[model samples]
Structures are given as structure tokens and as C-alpha cells.
Target: MYSKGWIMMELTMNWITLRVRNLEASLDFYHRILGLPVERRFESRGKQIVMLGIEGQPKLELIEGSDPPVKPECGVSVGFEVASLDKAMAELAKEGIPVARGPIAPNPSLRFFYILDPDGFEVQLAEHM
Candidate 1:
């Protein structure tokens, strides 16, 4: 028999892994551009992997040389919180990374924009007002 309170299930996002074509380029985008520090890096099954994130937060894992190479899907993106969208855009401009989409504020408390990573993955940066 099933009861509403009988099942105990907890869900959390541990990490997101992406198979990248170029490790250094991806590293430049994620580590240098986005300023995410590399937490740890290691090799698994002959493939190199890098995890990037702030302490005690979900990680974004970048993997290179994985079997059955994968292409990033369109319309799928990873969003990040930014202190200021204007500052982020200026920094990106200095690095010559163009904005893929707008700094749209659909509501009173949100503004955001998108940029393409080295692997053509959509990276969204948002600032809450």
C-alpha cells in the first residue's frame, strides 16, 4: 500500500557534465571568462575531466576526449547569477565574446543575457534587481 508520507525521497543537483571539444578553450571560457575556479581535475577511463564551481555549490564538469563525442544541444543552457549584468557584459566585451541574446528584463526583478561558450553551449548570466 502507498501512503502520502511513506516514501522519503530527496533530490539534489550534484553536477552537470559536458563533453567539450577543446579543453583549453573551454577552460578559458569557464575558468577565465566566467571566473569559476577549478575545484578539481582528474582522468577517468582515459578521458580528462575538470570540475568548476564555488565551494559547497553544484559543479559544472567539463570533460574532454570522451568516447562517442557529444554535441551540445541547441536551446539548452546553464544559467549563472551575476552581481551586475552591465559589468559582466563589459568584461565579456573585453574578451571579444559577443552576447548571444539580450539583457532582457521580463519582470521587475530580473535581467539577463546569453553568451556562447567555446563549445557553442549557451551560457546565461542574470542579475536580480
Candidate 2:
């Protein structure tokens, strides 16, 4: 039997996987645009997979799928924290990547905005005040 204060098993987030139609486009956005470094890459069952993240953290995996991949569900998004929202926004604008939604601050302590990835999945960039 396990004691009240003892843990039997610990859980942690491993990674988030996104199916992408164009691997080059996805890499351009995620690597060049957002500045995520590629952790590793491999192939399985005729499909290529690329993982990106910092050391000792959960990764973002992009799996190469069929051209014209299936549409992602509505209202699902992944958010990343930025040191400066204004700088990030400026960089994005320089790249000609339009903001799909808000640079809205619902509260004084937070500000955020959304952009669409190549596959039309929502990607959010936020900064804490």
C-alpha cells in the first residue's frame, strides 16, 4: 500500500504533435519565424516527424501528412509565452504574417494575440505584465 504522502507515479507533459501538410512551410513558420530549434527528427511508416523544443522541456512535434490535410477542429489553440509582445508582433509583421485575432489584454497583468499556422491551427503569443 502507498502512504498518503508518498507518490506511486509521476506524470509530466511529453510533447504536442501537429499534423502538417507542408513540412517546409511548417518548418519556416515554427523554426525561422518563431525561433524554435529542432530537437530531433525521424521517420516512421513512411511519414516524417520533426520535434522542436528547448532542453529538458516538452516539445512540439510536426508530422508530415498528406497534402491538403484534414482541417483542425475549431477553437483549439496552443500558446507560447514571449518576453516582449511588442517585439514579437513587430517581427511577425516584418515576416508578413498577419495577426488572426487579438492583441487584447483581458486583464492588466496579461496581453496576448493569435496567429494562424500553415495548417490553419491557432498559435497564440502572450506576455505577462
**Model 2, runs deviating above 4 Å:** 1-9, 67-70
Q: Using TM-score as the measure, which candidate wins?
A: 1
CA-lDDT, candidates in order: 0.89, 0.89
Residue-level lDDT of model 1, residues 1-129, one tens digit each, is: 965563446556779888888888999899998999999999888988999999999999989985543555745688999999999999999999999999899999999999988888889999999
Where does candidate 1 have its weakest 10-residue lDDT segment?
A: 3-12
> Which lDDT value does model 2 have at 86?
96
Per-residue lDDT tens digits for candidate 2, residues 7-104, read 43576688988889888899889999999999998998898899998889899999996645656665667789999999999999999999998999
**Cα displacement (Å) at residue 3, model 2:** 16
Against the hidden true structure, what lDDT does model 2 obtain? 0.89
Cα TM-score per model: 0.89, 0.88
Q: Model 1, 10: alpha-carbon shift in Å?
A: 2.2
